[model samples]
Target: MLQGKPLLGVTLVITATLLFAINDATNKYLLVSYDVPLVAAIRNIVHAILMIAILGPYQGHRLVQSTRPGLVIIRSVCLTVGTLFAGLALQLMPIAETTAIIYLSPIIVVLLARPILGESIGIVGWLAALGGFAGVVLIARPGGGLDPLGVIFALCNVGATVSYYLLTRILAKSERTLTLLFYSALIGAILFGLAMPWFWFGAMPSNFEIILFLSLGVTAGLGHFCFTAANRYAPASVLAPMTYSHLLWAGILGWLVFGQLPDSWGLAGMLVIAAAGVAVALRTRFARR
Candidate 1:
């Protein structure tokens, strides 16, 4: 029932990618001075509050209602763990490289879909998946200068993300988009918020730090909103390739905010991953037709 507006959808998705890149940069900056739990707690708390204030009146009981409550909770847990891993990775690695590694999730999904979802990926899909893994090896190659622990965290995030995406694929058939989004924010807020006292030992955030902390939720919430809204205007095929724009934005922000740029090898790895992901997306689209 959604209207087709490909151009608008592309714009919104690109905007979402930029906002998310900014959020990641902000997270990396804050993680330098704060623990992962505290940072994640504040981000989700603000995000939950914003969602309630904006969607509560309009959505009412529907915001919390889910026919697949258990699966929804599982999905939310995946997101929560992914957030923690991502924060830990950002704390130790450059944003551009971390983001590139995290993107391995899509490729991982392709590899798993045949066994898990019973969808055949064909020869091209297998090759693309292999190429994607090779790209990660390049990024994490010996003498690449990346923190090994950070690479591990990024890979952990990829696992969480692959599970999240698979669950989303199953649940999308039965759930409303807002319900899923709200639960993700709600669960993250509750889990991290409960763990805050132990991780709350840092110096009180400065006025500017508080602002940055608050902006985390704003940017994240807006990015999700834009991403969801974009789906209403464009098909998944159009949106899929556009998601790769995140790497470009991440690289730019990483340089501008953190003065960090990926080395040539890292850049090449990112391009390979992007190319493979695009190939997978386009192949899926054509296969569907």
Candidate 2:
């Protein structure tokens, strides 16, 4: 709650969002350059390493300490499902589109917060939720004729993301942040590993591919760490919508790396989502102050 920490949290969240967007954009590039199943597998393997080797030094005890074991377990599993599902969505869909759909996570979080977290949101949160949902609809709508499979994956990611944050909210009180990160990574590795056999066609990544895949894990892990801290230091109302900054970052990365940019529709939808989220963030700040 110190001035520096909250400011750090906000900056961390923004930077994390940028890294996360870059992660997706890079993953998309690698997905094109390499095999999906293999890229997915390597990403997990490297990520699992980061969880154990990298995070252990900072906060190792978080993994074993527990106040809500069942909640932690459920949250881990849900995130595993969500992460793998989102990866599959990426394999089927364009990166930019999938990223937009994933923005729906905050809307789901607001909706679920009432029942799960017993948080009372005012009209502003609801309006933001509605606007965010509309953005998803705009992207997924049939007239756009986005690939049906892509839409399915994107929507699945929405659920996966919601489950992730919901569990994060549940764990926020009890679990050490490291423990939460480890669980998500551990579950994602195992769950996705199991599915690997079904989809695995081993096209071993080139040296460059290996680095790219590892960066995926690093970006995600660090990004999530910052993301968690953001919620910890500030209210969700302050931080939740800021997560949507990923879109702006993603659009830039997509163009710079892949020469892909969201069209007019994508820009319009993102603007609506941004406006709605910013409004919610502003309202929350005002109410809290």
lDDT of each: 0.95, 0.74
Candidate 2: list runs displaced more than 4 Å. Answer: 1-6, 33-37, 57-61, 229-237
User: What does the lDDT come to for candidate 2?
Assistant: 0.74
Q: Candidate 2 at 133: error in angstroms?
A: 2.1
Q: Tell me the lDDT of candidate 1.
A: 0.95
lDDT per residue for candidate 2 within 162-244, as digits (tens), equals: 88788776777777777767776776677667766776555666897667877988888788777876766666656756677
| Per-residue lDDT of model 1, residues 138-199, tens digit only | 99999999999999999999999999999999999999999999999999999999999999
Model 1 alpha-carbon miss at residue 222, Å = 0.2
What TM-score does prediction 2 earn? 0.88
TM-score per candidate: 0.99, 0.88
Error of 1 at 223 (Å): 0.2
